[model samples]
Target: MASDPEDRAAAQRELASLKFAQAQDKAKQDPAAAEKLVRESLTLAPGDEKAVDLLGRVIHAQGRLDEAIQVLGEGDGKSCDMCKRYLSVLLLERAGKREAAKDFEGARTDYSRATELIPDATTALAVARSSEQLGDLEGMTRAIEKAVPLIRPEDTAAQTEFLGFRERTVLAAAGRGDVATCDRWLNFFPPGAGGDGWYVLQLRVAQELYRQKKVDVAVTRARTMLGSTHTDTLPANRKTEFQRFLADIYRLQGVGYLREGKLAEADDNFRLAMEFLPGDDKIKLLRALAIGGHHETEKALQVVKALPKETKGHAEVMAILESMQVADRLAEGDVEGPRPRSRAQAASAETPEVHVAMAEILFITPAAGVNKGIVRQLKKSGIVKYPNDEVNRYGEALSELAWAREQARGLGEGYLFRGPGIDARMANLDRQLRAFTRSRSSSTPTARRS
Candidate 1:
């Protein structure tokens, strides 16, 4: 081997030439192949700086960014500062290693060493975003301030990034109850032109207004947000929530109109809400429509009948439907439907409890509770007493009534007075049964008459 020095030297030169050619070919299209060539060249000549830089570039291109960092890491005093600084930044980003990325002080060291290594707006913006994601708000502010001078006025990306930062800052300030900071942030935004940020800010303001009981202002702000074309900027699910909020606004408006005796307007808004509402409570809108005489009560009942059976509103809605049928019958001089109105009337005519039960079942709300029909039935029975045996049967009815009351709570304040009427009807039913029993005993043959 010592005698073959010339031959070994010739073989090394040949190997170097082959690696250079392979690296050139790979550099055009394949980073992985380029990586292999550069690494091999470095292995043959361990002190070659060119081979090390080329290897770092290839690794960075292949997204093995950490490898690039390690390759360029050895060049501190031996190679140019520019390569090391650029390689470090790229390494941190590609690896999603923010701690390494924010080694800005370290980067500044290398950047200061390189004579023409000017820091640009894009670099600063990226660093700012990284800092923000890492919860380094002070660092973000510093980064943006440094980058601002390099950003041209027309640079849309820079503007957008800055606005996003501003939004986060405002939200953070609001969370901290720093009203002065929030107001400063708000001043940067004009009326309605800032896309989703505009709506978000308005929504926050509306919430504050609601908390302060500024109902009109809150409603106006909520309406403005939902009505904006940029409302579509919200995610599909959030858009649904906004729509529901808008519906709630309409519901409140409907109540206001009702209180003001603007029945037509109240009914219109309630109907509009029902049109957009997602669930079975649309019956409420229809009921409002009926009670307000927005259309004939008959028309509202028709709306109820048109709903599917599985809807949450079905039982109350169907009873409304039945009541309308009765109303229509009465309109034509027929007092009642095919079924008798009173249980005692039916019982006196030898009606079976099974049939009565079947008829009464329709009045039971699915979620449980009393209904106006139950009141009507007990009232017609002329019951005027309450006792232990009767109270148990009545408790079952009251349980059903309790469920109805729960359902009604969402309907609003007007129905609160109806509960007392229900209690009175139960008392009357007990009295009638007792009186009937007493009269039956008195008329027996072994009694006074006998």
Candidate 2:
């Protein structure tokens, strides 16, 4: 019997296979009996992958997870597919038990091993969740990435579960101000997977970007979300809040540009802000300041003058208007005075009729300066009879008209400044100036003509 080692080895292998078959049959009915049989098989054929896998499963069924993991892990899982599959299952069971005991590191390690063996969505997601529990966001992200593509499209429940997990990760990342992690997880969220929580996360990211002085990136992100269909479907109040946030970003950008002396850029940003917050008086004031920075004092004055009377009365608004007026005078080379005449001085100096008549002369005349006819008209109106200082006279007429307009506005819409009134004439002048400005900036001949 001992003469031929080859025959003896074959007989032992046959016995081992028989024992393993019996172990498989009894594994569900009596794990204890199954474990005994699998052990016999492994002893007969040492290192047999099938016998090892069966032993691990029976041990696991008896709730000896650590022992089962050790038995299965001793086999060559890399070379034997059956061994790898069995080891993965046992590892998952052990990981869940570890998680229950608050052994997060052990659980993550076990889950990771299972995922490496199986590489399926279930195991991968398990690893992700375990990694999350351990506060290993980078590990969690990597696990989720692996799980996503492995999920079958028909398995909608799994997809939904994964999305929920991803959303949680995103919010968690945002809560800790982990911008890169937050953005990565957010990208993993499928369209429509992002509910209100998704928008909240996006807003948080945008706010963080703004705080970091990454204004352009923040603006782009917020603007894109604002225009998204998801945002359009939000509750009205929520949409308005989002819009206000974007408007604030734009306003801040405008202020930055103003400080840097980038007048055109500042004006453009404020205009965009107004689109979001059309009734924001503060933003409107900022736009006027930007225009004044461009040396377009009259245009800036027009914007300030058109504000609600209450806003016009604000000290800040008055200061801005006075600064623009002073800049206008300096541009006209009127540097003789220590300060421009105050609104009180202008109001005390002129009657309402005289101010209105002067406004009419300035409105009708060409930009080259007041001609002889216009001077006579102004003289008849009791302003600048000589017209030697045409620039100062024009500026004085504007200031007077501005003061008269404020007075008339205070008295209500029905109280006119005088014949033909300041309202109609001012409106006409604004329209003409706006048209002219547009003509100079645009390439279209029709726009220039209009």
Candidate 3:
């Protein structure tokens, strides 16, 4: 025991300071080596909060985050808000490591804890991204919503960036027809304060509402978006996006309902579709079918009756009129409904995905074959799958599938309804039928070989 207590106290402070300074210098060049100096500094003067925090960081720099967190926690016991919030950064960095490892669940947990502690934009974004990786869409939306208040009201760029992330997720989910996921995201960004995000989300909401057969709600949402004076970041060409996208939804629903023999519903949907695509002949034909199928013979007749005389004389119009007559005649007897599933309906079971992800990540650079982006963009532009593309570079897989299917269908009736030339043959027959009927009366069907 040194008889001088003052000397012992003075020695402890001096050593602690010297060791802490050395630790800082070493940390810049060699974090692992700095760990030793930082530990020594903490021991020289017990409960040195700064030394504890520094030691945590030094260890953390060496990728020992668990230990870093434990070490910092001890200091945090005596520290105030300053160092406590710093811990959230440590947590976020660690979560990134876990995310890189595809330990998404662990990353989500870490981000959740960090965001709960900090409740700020940085941590909230971490939470949202981690949740997206985990496919916890609800969690992702919740995290993004939590970030809204933290964003500066004047930072439109920041607001767009955050909402852009959500939009990607929303559109991707909707493109896959993941209705549950789309609807969950729609719960946020209703009208008001959200600005661009809210307007964009409404587009998806209306699309999904139509998919769900909530036609009125979907139409209302579309009309509201069309009417919104609020501007968004999308290009002006996309101004009619709500109407165009809703038209697609209505057409899809009309096709599905027509297949299901829900003629009345299909009629309404097709009518809604014409509001956006007034010239869509397929929509008009389908609406007539819907009316006739629903037993509205007069309404079904009225559709064809309303067509121009030249149009009424077209084969397509006559066919629809024939369908109406069949419905009227069948009014007296039981007519077997079509099978539970129809080919048209089967197509809508999943939304059409125009272009799949080029690479697992948006950009992948390897010193090898054609870049995935090139392939993806080519496919997106409909340049892939050409007869000349396969066996050379891109679209080899798709070409193989097409060739195999073509070869198999040639082998039997299983593919009787599908093939390359069958469409042309069908079209030829349709043309002949239309040509033959171009001069006939609406009541002058039943042409025979007499």
Candidate 4:
């Protein structure tokens, strides 16, 4: 124990150095003990760089990462190469452990902390990886962006690998519908330097610019993405994601044209979407709407005919086609009102004189789907008397036997019907009415209305 002030200060440094040396030996076999010893050394000599480095390393080796970083921070404001290197390596090991244990957020914290010590490519990649695992796509993207510049341009492999990671970040953002964020990553490379994702990003940007009412710019941006001068010419069957991205761009720009009352341009864009994604109901529906909006009801009807059967949207398409046909007739200046649609109105609908006409119309109507659902509901509610209502009603027994004959003749149920589905019962009723009418007229007899 020294007595004088200068002597005491000198002794403190010497004793702290000695304790730090002991801590180093303890670190290999017993990190907890080494951490305690290093802490005491730092307490005696608060700015001892070796003690700071040893404490961080020992605690980290003991799996106490957060505390290790805190200990490492002790000499952060001062220049000490050993402490910096130890902090960097300690953070990387901690991040690796967290990532392996599937603790993404913890790994992200460690990786990001490592970058603060040194902007190393390996650590930066780890940061991006952890961010991706955490579903922090924007964070992943920013991490890649910040780290890429740190890579020397001559290191082509590192640059190319970083570019691949950047593409992945862009793809993840696309999957989550984070289109606007994709633009921030564009400045990192020259135009088209990052691969096909750059075009995908441009498409999303066009969508947003269109949304914000930048019409000319939006159209220009969207057209540029398609590699076309005309808005109608979009790339087709490009990679799956590229096609989808292009289709989405067309849909937005098409709708924008539609809303602007530019029917021709709208048709062009909608058709381009169709070329990229054939048999897309939503796109087809939009096409029909555009044609109807242009007063081309016949063309619109043809578009509706292409919709897939037994789907809700298909049913809606049927309704739209019927509406267009009605509107087309109305445009021809007819005085007649549209037909009535209820059971009370069934005299005109169900009369034998109108049986075939009514059945044909009902078979093609969109309301048929709704009625099918109602039939299911009726069954579920235990309301229908029997599934054999066909054999008990007037003229029903005759129709059933007639269908048996028709079946023997290889006419199969509804084989001659002119509608969507084949219902054996409805086919029999139509056949019975037609046969009765032919016999009555040919035999010179006055038959019951049918």
Best by TM-score: 2
- For model 3, what is the alpha-carbon lDDT of residue 261? 55
Model 1 TM-score relative to the real fold:
0.37
Candidate 4 deviant stretches above 4 angstroms: 1-6, 14-44, 58-70, 74-82, 154-161, 172-178, 190-192, 195-219, 225-450
lDDT of 2 by residue, 155-270 (tens): 77767778778768766665565768777778775334556766776877777677777777777777777786665566666677778988887777676666556767877888
Question: How many clashes in candidate 3?
Answer: 0
Using all chains and alpha carbons, the TM-scores for the candidates as numbered come to 0.37, 0.56, 0.48, 0.43
Using lDDT as the measure, which candidate wins? 2
Q: After superposing candidate 1, which stretches have Cα over 4 Å from the reference?
A: 1-218, 225-245, 252-299, 302-316, 320-393, 403-450
At residue 372, candidate 3 shows an lDDT of 61
lDDT of 4 by residue, 1-450 (tens): 457876888898888888898899999999989988898898889867777777778888887777887777655524556687777777777788889999999888878877887887667777888888877777887787777767775767667667677666555554554556555666577322544555555665555565565656655655455554422433343344445656766776676666455768877988988887886777777677677666675687677667666533444444434443443444465425564223212322222212322333332333323455555664454322223222123234344434434543463321211111113424555664456436435443233333
Off by over 4 Å in 3: 6-11, 22-37, 60-65, 75-89, 113-122, 151-165, 168-201, 227-450
What lDDT does candidate 4 reach at residue 39?
A: 86
Cα error, residue 241 of model 1, in Å, equals: 8.4
lDDT head-to-head 2 vs 3, winner? 2
> Could you give the candidate ranking by TM-score, starting with the highest?
2, 3, 4, 1
| Clash pairs, model 4 backbone | none
lDDT of 3 by residue, 1-450 (tens): 167786998888898899999999999789988888888887888667777778877888888889877676554434534446667788788888898999988888878767766777766777788887777777888887887667776656556667667578767876665757665665654223354555667676667666676777777766766664544454354556876877777777776666455656766887888998788665665566555565564675577566654542234433434433432343344234431122222322111110011110111112246566665664455422323232132233233334434543464542111111222323333343344234332223243322
